[model samples]
Target: MASLQNAKNESHIPAELLIARVMQIHACICKLESLKPSKQVNSLFTHLVKLCTPPSSIDIKTLPQEVQEMRESLIVLCGRAEGLLELEFATFFAKTPQPLNNLNLFPYYGNYVKLANLEYRILDENGVVQPKKVAFVGSGPMPLTSIVMAKNHLKSTHFDNFDIDEAANDVARQIVSSDIEFEKRMKFVTCDIMQVKEKLGEYDCIFLAALVGMSKEDKVKIIKHIRKYMKDGGVLLVRSAKGARAFLYPVVEKHDLLDFELLSVFHPTNEVINSVVLVRKPLF
Candidate 1:
């Protein structure tokens, strides 16, 4: 384990070593949360916070692709740990039962509500009042953003959801299946964004969740990959944390966006993040 001082001097550490360490920390947190004792959970949560907090100068380009993908899981796990500790919840899945009809994302309601507002603002500003096809990448268990869009923006048949977590994808599929119209309209897949090879040229808009972890290489490759498949004038909406939330959902810089044309940046009204809208510049 690197000392806090050693963390500050990250140049000495190998990228693969760091990646392995981070991935192990992520897996450990996932397992530890399932144990009964609250004290044990708190102790693991504290240790994880230290392990996952990267040094400001840490070069993301050096990390492995798998580690980059697991970053968001760590962030969300850390956030859930904090919330769980505060609420005195015994285990990770200690939340109150949800009614089948209401897909309320309790703790995460604020995040999705803010995203819904930002989506509308972007659509209005870009004169895309009604996007024909929309994709939600890294959609979690509830897929609240897709739910909101189905109610307000996209037709049920025009939505596609993707996530790397099979369990999450299953839950999201189940939720979408609960509504006949949504079941007919939505397609949910369990896959990494970087590995998708199917034709996606029909989707005019794509939403990247705040926790969609991507290293510099991962970002570039996926952007290029999606660029090839997305409609010529497609818009990619990337949600990232700003200010102090960078400890978890790190800020996504302009350089990381690579060759895409940046359209606008929108700050959330009730959250600690900002959203970037990027457009596919027309081909010559």
Candidate 2:
């Protein structure tokens, strides 16, 4: 649909506070990275970096080389963080579903449920049902989006999770396998979307994760690639950022999705992210 206003404007958080947060996040990243060469550490570092980004008004480029380099490094780190975070989350929950306090998972799950509800409402309005194939690009380790959708929506029989990290895939599979009932509803694959050449048009629904792309350019490319393989009239649910969350990465604007018919846009009343639902345009 059309672009909507954000629930709140977070730019008023104060420049001094933003600077302080950057320092805190930077120190945390340094400490975590120093501990080991684990993927979890790398993922945390990337998150810390994204959380550290200041508002656009403050130009980080004017800083010293070292500082500028640090900002630059965060860009690269966030791209890797997706797979790394999946690996970390998968390892943590592989034994049990309980999340550690340090993971700060409650907000994450809450946000997922909020967005999933939006997906559910749209599907219901459109008369979408179960036994329909659904694929989640960038499923991460937990696949919480799919899990939430399954629990809340109860539609979409087979949910396929695709990610580049094999470890992440293993974690998702383990989590899904833990529940025999859910086992049949979910499948995890460890290939990048670009690598899957055939049978890509089978899905009735697709989800592109919030952190799937490294940059705006990358996101556009990924969307364009997936658009080619989508079954006509199939729905695409994209989780995008807004307001404060835009600091993590630039949010997808209306122009970014002109190739598809924008069905609707849903902004979370309590959360930071938004959802954009679209359908493929007819071949001319």
Show pairs that collide, candidate 2: 130-156
Tens-digit per-residue lDDT, 44-83, candidate 1:
5444444434333345545556755677566667645543
Error of 1 at 190 (Å): 2.0
Q: Model 1, residue 43: what's the lDDT?
A: 58
| Global lDDT of model 1 | 0.61
lDDT string for model 2 (191-263, tens) is 9888774556888778888777756678888887887777777777776654434434445767888888877
Candidate with the greatest lDDT versus the true structure: 2
How close is every model to the real structure, measured as TM-score? 0.65, 0.72
Off by over 4 Å in 2: 1-11, 14-86, 97-107, 126-131, 272-274
